[model samples]
Target: MNTRVNETERKRIAAAISVWENEGGAPGQDSMHHQYGRRIEADHSWTIYHVFTGVPARFGGDAMTGLSRMDATSGMLRLNLRNAERRRERIELSSFRAVPELAECGS
Candidate 1:
């Protein structure tokens, strides 16, 4: 399906993602949220893989307004998946912000 979100919904989702990240992600972690999204790889891991905002209809209205939404997020999931030395090294050398070597999901 092609269910895109609006700017308002984007901000809302960003806030929700921030809350989730605050509770689970490590303290003082380097991320694209802090950086200006110069590092695509790093940003991708957080904005795409770790969070649910990347998913459609996970929050806000899903064909209806004023309805509660369910989130399917596994905070820090990728960090555990990519436990390889080389992967970590690549992310580190990326500059701007190093992307976490996010591991795969098991479902």
Candidate 2:
């Protein structure tokens, strides 16, 4: 299984996350932490895993995680970016861990 989010999609996802973080988005709800998977070079879809720490205990306390299936055409990284955009709650990340593969992209 080639679970690699291509450079193009990775940047887009990173940008969206940056915006969400800067604007104070909530804990990802159904909007986040959902399991998603994709094979490499199949219909231009990609899969990436995200692990977030420093989240409030109510949300899951230091082990918040999610996966996104990115479409080449639509670029859907998170499960629901709209949900994240609507909320203005803050989440603190003491440490951020993306897939080891992403490190190659310097994410």
Candidate 3:
């Protein structure tokens, strides 16, 4: 029930959203793997997830140091980051309630 949202975290979420929108819908399973691998190649500091169709997972930089996965059917995105300090700024599911369009595939 923590409602606190920081500016940096907001910006990061916005960036991730933009990336998801501009990249054309939630990635397919293979595309998701390739995208994550490419992103790791470009910047190993961040991780990616698509827990609900087109909704991209937004992790705190520190909260994404290790491994993660998005279970679309269960709407659960699990993260196993090594740093506790970085995991404090998670984007809750409530934040996405208003953006239902993100859950649909784009043409």
Candidate 2: residue 84 Cα off by (Å): 19
Ordered by TM-score, highest first, the candidates read: 3, 2, 1
lDDT of 2 at 68: 27
Tens digit per residue, CA lDDT, model 1, 60-95: 323111222222223123333333444557766564
Off by over 4 Å in 3: 1-5, 28-107
- Candidate 1 regions exceeding 4 Å error are 1-5, 25-107
Sort by lDDT, top down from the best: 3, 2, 1
Q: What does candidate 3's lDDT look like per residue over 1-107, in tens digits?
A: 24456777888999997656433345454333222211231432334433334334544533333332222211222232222223333344444444678544321
lDDT of each: 0.35, 0.36, 0.38
Q: Is candidate 1 or candidate 2 better by lDDT?
A: 2
Q: What is candidate 2's lDDT per residue for 1-107, written digit by digit as tens?
A: 34465777888999887555433345454545322222233443333223243221122233122322323112223433433544433322212224455555565
Total backbone clashes of model 1?
5
Taking all chains together, each candidate's TM-score versus the true structure is 0.20, 0.22, 0.22
Q: State how far residue 86 of model 2 sits from its true place (Å).
A: 23
TM-score of candidate 3 against the unseen true structure: 0.22
Error of 2 at 43 (Å): 41
Task: Give model 2's TM-score versus the native structure.
Answer: 0.22
